[model samples]
Target: MDLIPPPAADDAAARAEVADRADAYAAAPLLNCLLREVAEPLPRADGSGDRRVYRLPGGRPLRVRGQRRPAEPEVFTAGNWQRIGHTELVKLVVEELVRHTGLSNHELPAEMIDSRDAVAALLTARARATPPEDPYLRSEQSLLTGHPHHPAPKARGGGPVAGWLPYAPEAHARFPLALLGLREDAVVEEGDTSALDTLGEAPPGYRLLPAHPWQLDLAARDLAPAFADGRLVRLGTTDFPAWPTAAIRTLYAPGRDLFLKFSLDVRITNDIRRLWRHDLLKLRRTDSAALSAFAAIDGPAAWLSDTGYRTADFAFEELAVLVRDGLRDRVLPGATPLLAAGLVEGFDGSPLDHAPDPAAWWEAYLAQVVPPALAAFADHGVVLEAHLQNTLVAVDAGGTPVQALFRDAEGVKLLPEVSRAAGWERLVYCLVVNHLTEVAAVLADRHPGLDPWPAVRRALSRHDLPEVAALLTAPTLPGKTNLLLRWTGADGADARYLPLPNPLVET
Candidate 1:
């Protein structure tokens, strides 16, 4: 693997140098190319502070402290190194090394083991045999994905003709609008006796009452409160410009306060179905008191329905609804003073930043929020999505989290199927690693000296239920990795890159 020399120890000098290098590194076309090949980011230590650590996707941590004594940098205590599969690491290392060293592939080392034990032994031997001070001794790896290019498609004009309101340009590209009805200007009323009658007539091409396949069953039962309460007046769609994933989300506004999410992709749709299936089933089997307690708490008001539709490609097929107010105004944007101010910022401009106290945020979340949620699921064999977006932070009068409103029933998980095998790992990765890590990072940035792990442990304890405290102290599930690296400052100039390990695990 190609090894970049450690930056100078002088803080001021290193900062300037690292900044310059980071800009060039981020802009490098060759780096992007390499990222695409590896399917992950190049691993490096955050050089900003004393603890120079390595992080990876899914919260895997490798501590890479460099001692610049004998003229060489030695990476110490690279724990969880075995979890990433040595072969994948070797491939990434070899490719990056070839690029940096300008060496042919034929000159690189060959992989000889597939098992973790063998790979660990090999790494130990390699570390010992190599000269500690040799600049070329350490190998670093990164994945190269292709550049981001495709913009989301724009929504086609249709349904009733009303004043066109352009959505926020930067928020998203594609917009989905619910079709209410066609305007009378496009068609004439049949046997109209007056101008008013003519103006109210339904257009010829417009179906007075078109139904979404997923809503058919609910519609037949006359169970849609949004339509009855005048909440879901129209269907709205939006894209995630910031997120690279190919998902077009549609929101059904039941009221100004409630929203339903629908996606065009089957994978996401099916995942939702699996999640809800488990949740509802668990609810059915759970004690009435438990269910009632959950219902009483202010959670996201929602229900899942496919009507009769099976595919995700159909127009306006799936639907969900945001329930009416059970939460206060400060945290809920619709109810706050910031609601009217177009320029007003909400929750530090990110849902993850909604907490008042970073340390307390995790404390209340795990202790009060996650336990009831997981218990609600355990009672009925359901698993909630509980990811960042699917969850809403409901604060009390003091802005403390009294309740957690978990929405998106489609993302709920069933116990036996989801918890067993890799499903549990996937859930933990998405909810804790991917989602919670962002929140933790923001909190740590806001409040220095506060540890994020206690909060994590609290939540895990509640999820484990009767064995809560023991679970808190127990060793976390192994083989999970989260690799998140933050640049201490500007790149390539003199910046330190620290990779944080999965905080869920004890060091």
Candidate 2:
């Protein structure tokens, strides 16, 4: 008998641990959605101690071990509690949702499962891969369990792992862009697309077009004829590798100081991650408005403008690539720009983790982040999607936040296009609920007895907008219903929200 376990045994244990961690990672958001949307908290009649029990829509009692990231879910069945894994959790959620909504969804359960599998794949790949040296890039790639409340934040369209792994930001993936030469006549572009020409050389009659390799594979069937004809020709790949950011479809080329966002057909969170033709048509107007809004702002707050886009007329949405303003030009000097989501999710050098004075740090964060978003809405009628992923908080050498930069014109909404009430609700949801609330919760958790809400209340008090007063006094805030939205097959752009208790008022 061998005293030491074999390598195979060790490997099996490691894989099992990875799978278990993946299940926990995947279950938190699903549990959050179920509890938020359908589950009703039952009174502590039985003195359940630390365990919080909720009545499922199906009238069954379900218990969980924690809040924020709920875990160790068990259902009370036949007068006994049975622990459920990610698969069982999905089934339970599907049954409860069906009973609650009176609608059956075949797609969401698959997505939930796909999300868990994707997490397993990401964990495996991350263990073997080298994390980028740049803290910003590290921050960008840190979201292993993304969009903490979305049921399937990590889903990769249920595709094979190999199909999407090479381009996954969470896996710390970096790869060269597949360069293509598009015939001059087929090139449709707007704004300053001169940067595209600098990427690589094209023949006299052709223009250089850089494509995400994954996108190319996804659109191969649609672009076959163009490649066969003289309209499109393969020109190899870029000499340098591009770093994928938190937004999986967007890539950051460090050497060139450029961001190139490509159309991805896969469903990430609520929508198919594609650059729709409608969005492309309105890109100039929307991006220009954001640029103007940021320009008029008083502080160092900046907007990373989506300056232009280029794509083939024959396969417009399939191959469209947006040219976005890179960090070098816009970010404040002597400060490092970190993804707001990464700060919430956390990374090795996260400022939130190392803040010397959590209270002061919170104030500085609110000062940088809150003002610009409110000013944009009040002064310019440009409602920024100031959510975690869209916002970047730049910190000084001491890891204190000094500036805030917002991006993604595709999510921005102009004033009259949406009614002011609607825009204000969306803004509050994105800024307060999605961005600050998550950050505040993490901060409070890290430093116990630290009330982060007083500073938040103070921050809003400084903003004189009429909505600010009502916002502070309001009993509730609008929280988007991502799980139900996906289950009901609602349009991703159609944001339906439910009321969540207002922390500001409660505090």
Candidate 3:
């Protein structure tokens, strides 16, 4: 009934709405990153659950008015506590981080602001937009606040709303791919790229290449010479629209049962979304291993393989489009494959949003997801980055999770590349800390008095891996420090984590 409710009548109410909405949306992740990385939580003197407090670097007393994801920040100033909006909160982060790390960062502060502003834009745009008819697409686009642990998950490279909204999945965007023809001599491709050539006819001496228009736009300056020299020729746009997935760089074209991942020159969470040449070359090895692992699995688990890629030799990373396998082939018959991240984010048809049988649903979800990841690690030595976005779950009509599919070879760690010890640590972080913890929180939050951990423990305990026993008994798990990493200007891929209390352990 309150969808797109009228704006507040008076200026005061309107201002309050902006602050209240933006503060909660923007502050949560920032506080999550900060509290996890830098801020030290002080015990609540009154032992009140509603209001929790923390101390920043240099003993700056900081108190937030909520939990799960902290909000309504107030700093203990000269005498009493004073409330700060998102802007002041960001400033507090910068100042505290500067002192804490003994280094000043120029870009992260701007990125923090950009992320908050982006959230505001997304909130406004979503109110006016119509959600997609397909529950899968709707779920894909529902992540307004993405990567709940990242410091600037929604930041679009500090660009204005006008620049990025057209291609934003959060806006339910669907657009035509920019068609280009590369001189045959200048084209580089490996594996099954035959599907691309059929998109449209190329000139006698050229090869057809479809690109994300946004990526073409971003790489314009670097690509100007290629167009001028006639190495790259425009062939107009695709007749059918391709829907961008939750991973903004990837698009799913249902008409073709195809997924195309393009190189966008913007940072998404940890790294730039470009299909780096190094990863592109090694795709076959990683994907092959994943494919084999899934094949050996007992049940309905699947792996979405990144089969191949095509790009102009001159602009390998810029013009690259990695061809990822679509769901129709591997998805269980009579089941709908929805992105796991989308389910966690919650959309119109999220099965977990309100399950009639929370325990069974949770158990089913774990059975579908956990084993494949563990078996891949133990049997095939394939360490899956089983974080939410990289996973998909197919559900029956009754909304019970039936199958799990994992993707993203670029993130997969093969045996010998990493020691079993290191791989297990990474696996624990991605599967348990990033993926299961959030979902379990949601389940516990939604189904009151139901602790989801016991079910998770039972599910994981069944895995025969030596690590599972330790995992079930470990005191803490690795929690990635996104805020401190960014503040210290560390490489995005250089993941550093601190110990977090493991819920799997019984007191």
TM-score for each prediction? 0.43, 0.97, 0.96
Query: Which lDDT tens digits does candidate 1 get at residues 1-507?
Result: 112223346766654544433222222222222232222433455442443343323333433222210111122335422322224443544544444445544311221111122212222222223221211001000001011100001111211111111111112112333333322232222221131121122345432222223333323344355446442333222221111111223233212322223322222111222212223333333323333445554444222221111111111223321112222321444322111011111222332345556566567545544554555554555555555444544444454544444444344455565454333444454455435554565456566797777667756764545444433444543222111000111211121222233466566
| Local distance difference test scores for all models | 0.32, 0.91, 0.86
- Give me the overall lDDT of model 3: 0.86
lDDT string for model 2 (174-214, tens) is: 99999999999999998888888899999889999999999
Ranked candidates, highest lDDT first:
2, 3, 1
C-alpha RMSD in Å of predicted model 2 compared with the true structure: 3.5
Ranked candidates (TM-score, high to low): 2, 3, 1
What stretches of model 2 exceed 4 Å from their correct place? 1-10, 45-47
List of clashing residue pairs for candidate 2: none
lDDT of 3 by residue, 269-368 (tens): 7678889999899988998998899899888899999888999888999999988898899899999988888877789878886589999999999999
lDDT of 3 at 2: 16
Question: Would you list the clashing residue pairs of candidate 3?
Answer: none
The regions of model 1 sitting more than 4 angstroms off are: 1-248, 252-258, 265-293, 296-358, 396-398, 416-427, 462-507
Lowest-sum lDDT 10-residue window in model 3: 1-10
Candidate that scores best on lDDT: 2
